[model samples]
Target chain A: MSERVVAAAEEGQVVELRRSGRRPRAVANGVRAAAILVALVVLAVFPLVFSNPAVTTIAFFTLVFMTSTTAWNGFAGYSGYIPLGHAVFFGTGAYTLAIVAQDLHMPGGYGVFWLVPLAGAAALVVAIPFGLIALRTRRHTFVVITIAIFFIFQLLSFNLGITQGSSGIQTPTPPWFGGAFNIPFYYVGAVILVLSIAVSWFIRRSRFGLQTLAIRDDEDRARGLGVQVGRVKLVGYVISAIPVGMVGALYAYFIGQIFPQSAFDPLFDITIALMAFLGGLGTVSGPLLGALVLEPLQQYFTVSDPSYYLIAYGALFLIVILALPRGVVPTVGAWIGNRRARRAAPSPAAAGEASGGAPGGTRYAATVRSGE
Target chain B: MALLEMEDVRKSFGGLQALSACSLEVEEGSIAGLIGPNGSGKTTLFNIVTGYERIREGAVRFRGTAITNSTPERVFALGIGRTFQLTRIFTRLSVVENMLVATQRHEGWLRSVLRPAGSASEHRRAMELLDFVGIARLADAPAGTLSYGQRKLLDLACVLVADPSVILLDEPAGGINPTLIGLLAQRIRELNRQGKTFLIVEHNMEFVMSLCHRVTVMDFGKTIVSGPPDVVRSDRRVLDAYLGTEEADGDEAP
Candidate 1:
């Protein structure tokens, strides 16, 4: 009567065992807070802890690489648009700072620092039209378009007399502030890394993040659900470009020079992309973790044998892709989550009691119900 | 006046003529059904009204505002929400996260980045809808893992979280179990009682007959008959449209 057995069976298994919320917000928040505290402590004392000029230099580069990769991951990783030529923005930022400072005869140190944001702004502006055109085509097409743009910029820098042709422009070093200039540059790089990470964290939990993920999952469905796909992508592109641009400006200043080949290096894009993929594509900290691991490895390889470094890099990438296809963070997270779920599963007697139904009757009824 | 109105809407994909001179209306608080044999432009009409596809001929008005060629987001903002024939939930996201995405609006771009995903009230409403759909327990489960029937329910819940005045459901009973179909019907009736207007395109005759306040039958992208289910079910033209497709090929006389 009134589908009594059906109701009992549903209560017995599915309804009885089901947990409403699984996010574990409190525990996650605590863990995140603790991790942030530990990271900040380590970062603050890093220069002091290492006390080696070579180590500090490498650490500075690591921070710069982490900032750029994290910024790239914010949009490309989240939206599933592999930007093959993201170096466009990075190069643009470097070149903009170089051109402006040279053309304007700007003084070094704080005077030039004032225009760093302008470099970032220039890259952001450039990304708008480029993103609009490139995002019109998706997946592989978009990747190709980005690569085309990057190479075009590279060729322009090499040929344009305004950019000093192939010889490149020599940047003025910033006014030294107490000891080696690299110390201040290191701290600045660290600050940029922290800012980029914060931006990534913010976007990952924001409404904008949800829309991007929706687009990544299915563009048509996202549009159908009232997400302005074109506009969201453009905004995300601009945001992503801003940090990379700032980093480029910093890098140009740090090295006291900007060359067409180095400023617009295609390897920058490839390396950052590889870093993001190696860690976890969509996770906020993935790119940072990736940069930490891969940048040091690259540095070591480059010092040992610069010519064969790239071959080794390629081999390492293939190994990661073949062995851990889902990347480290997600693969490990999924494994731990599955184990936890198994341990959390209720026993049969406990499940029956929780269901508030006759054990034997509901168990038999549940078997029949599941057969459908 | 009808809550939603389509006046002589016509659409064509090159030469196929997906919809031709189609017109229908859904009154306030009524469950209106659109049915056809296979492809009589039922979905086409729904697409036109929801702004998924453009209408070549006529106008679509919602609450007396002409929204003939409005974008899907504009249509949704105007309180018209819809679900696809095939369920289109964001597969990688959790069920609650999917619901939150649907509840989002196109506001300030910077604000979206600055603010968190959904307000407390929005979260409450999303959870309530999930509960109403009987899938609250699966709120954190990735949507891809859900059964086809459960995905369908989640799809409906996503639309409901928007709290639209009018909902367009394309094939609400397609490929679902009978028990779930009955539950779906009950939910529709309950929502209708609360003054939510629905325009549903369903192939299941029994489900439509039991749930729809009135039914419209279409043949060859034209409305063949429109009335109460019993009347449309027994109409000569309707029967011919469903049973003998060849006989109803030519244009009907005015």
Candidate 2:
């Protein structure tokens, strides 16, 4: 009878079932959540036992890439803005920190830290004008506009000595952490990763997030429904730039080097875009998963033959686009949900009859039996 | 005085004269109907009056205010809510969410960002509107998942949520099942009795004749007749414009 009631509700029959006051489903959900939490906690603290500096450094780079991918995914996946020019923001952040540390001769770590967020702000300023122009066009045209803007920025950076043209700026290592291997950097990167996750979580649950989803589904209809489409898209674009910019600055500082060619590299944009797309768009954990899985492979390629890295990346992008268009999370989520539903035994109709036969079937049972 | 008046409204799309010096008036708190054959400028007049399309030459006055060249958003803010011929419901959003988007509120973007969705009043009002439109049961369901008739009801619910003084329904019964058409008529009459004015464009002559207090007939961008439904239905010009040469042949046969 309970199964029948659930089935009726699924079919939209409007069956008002009596409350049993039993909390089995709640208990099950709690247990599932706690298990996941425990698993995460174990993973977070597990590295302490290994104590390898090389592994810690690689993990730090993975976290930074994860942050960039998460922010990029939010805009491109949910909002449906194909931002081919994210490198503009990323490059800006890298150059901003590089210039501040090298030319300005500011105090090492703290100076670069304060300047990093400023780079994000500067990237936001650039994004505003770019968004205004790009958002005026639709779909493929918008993509072209973003790509063109990035190319323009790349060419200008190459011509101007402000960013050291092709040679690039040398980022100064912090005086205090100069000799230390990797633990402090690992902690900092982990914190940034947590912060990125929190920001992504906030965005997904916010009113802005809902509006972006509506805009993505149908812009003209969204407009008719009173959504300020242009303003919403612009805000999303600007918000997406912040983390990418900050990560770029951190990358420059970590490597103790920066160059126009390296800072504005198309590979940076393609890799982040590929990570976000492959993991899934519009999902909070997708980019993180993409970064975690793909970054290691990318590191391997860099070590093996750096020149052929683009070919491998390009092939992976093609495979992801063709196979998992909805992204990994939603596709896998739907499959798991379907599998669980299929495993539940004894058809609801049969259960309804079995229960209805019991002692003049209760009023609620009659409603459920009627399938109304 | 007319609550909404259009004087010599002329609108043209390049060579096509959609509204050739058309004129009409809608009295306050009355259910008015606009009807004609296909391409008779019924929708064009609605577009011009509601500020969706620009008029080449005309004056549109609403409550003694000139709204000739106002934007659609401005016209909506000025108390004119409209539904499209194609039922423009936000498909991916829930039925309640669709209505919520249209609710009258002072919360700008900044306030919406800061506040976790406002008081229960807005939500309660949205639920009331949904119930009024007979879609309360489907309130939580996605609007796109609704049947065609249900989507039409949702569109009406969204318009009603705005609490507009006057509503311009492009077609309240277009492509709707007969049973749903009856329900739509009843709802329109109920709202009209409650002092809400409506200007509806409908192709269903039977439904229009039964529900509309006054009917305006147009042809080739001009008003052919305007009077009570019975009188306008019998007008020679309306018949000629609607039936063409068949009107004369039918007169002799029947």
lDDT score for residue B25 of model 1? 88
Q: Write the per-residue lDDT of candidate 2 for residues A1-372, one digit (tens) a residue.
A: 122121233222222222333474577568857965884675477457546765666677787789888888778876877888888888888888888777677766655677777778878888899889989988999888989999999898888878768887888767664234455556556666677677666766556666676677667655544556677788888888888888788878888887777778777778888888887777777788889988878887888899888798889899999998756765665454333333342475644543422221222222121111
Off by over 4 Å in 1: A1-28, A175-179, A346-372, B245-254
Report the lDDT tens digits of candidate 1 across residue range B1-254. 88999989889999898887888988999999999979899888878887788766899999878999888877887789999998899877777889988777647667877889888998899999999988887675566656688889999999888889999999989998888998999999999999999999999999999899899999999987899999998998887887774535544533
* Candidate 2 residue pairs that clash: A168-A259
Worst 10 residues of 1 chain B by lDDT: B245-254
lDDT of 1 by residue, A151-205 (tens): 9989998998888988888776677844455677788778888988888878888
Q: Compared with the true structure, what per-residue lDDT tens digits does model 2 show for residues B1-254?
A: 88999899888898888888688899999989999889989888877776668875989999988999876656777788888898777665567767776653334665544444324887898899888877787665556556677888888888787688899998889998888888899999999999899998999999889988899988999887899999998888888887786757788886
DockQ of 1: 0.37
* DockQ each: 0.37, 0.29
Q: What would the TM-scores of all predictions be? A: 0.89, 0.85
Q: TM-score chain B for all models.
A: 0.95, 0.93
Candidate that would win on DockQ: 1
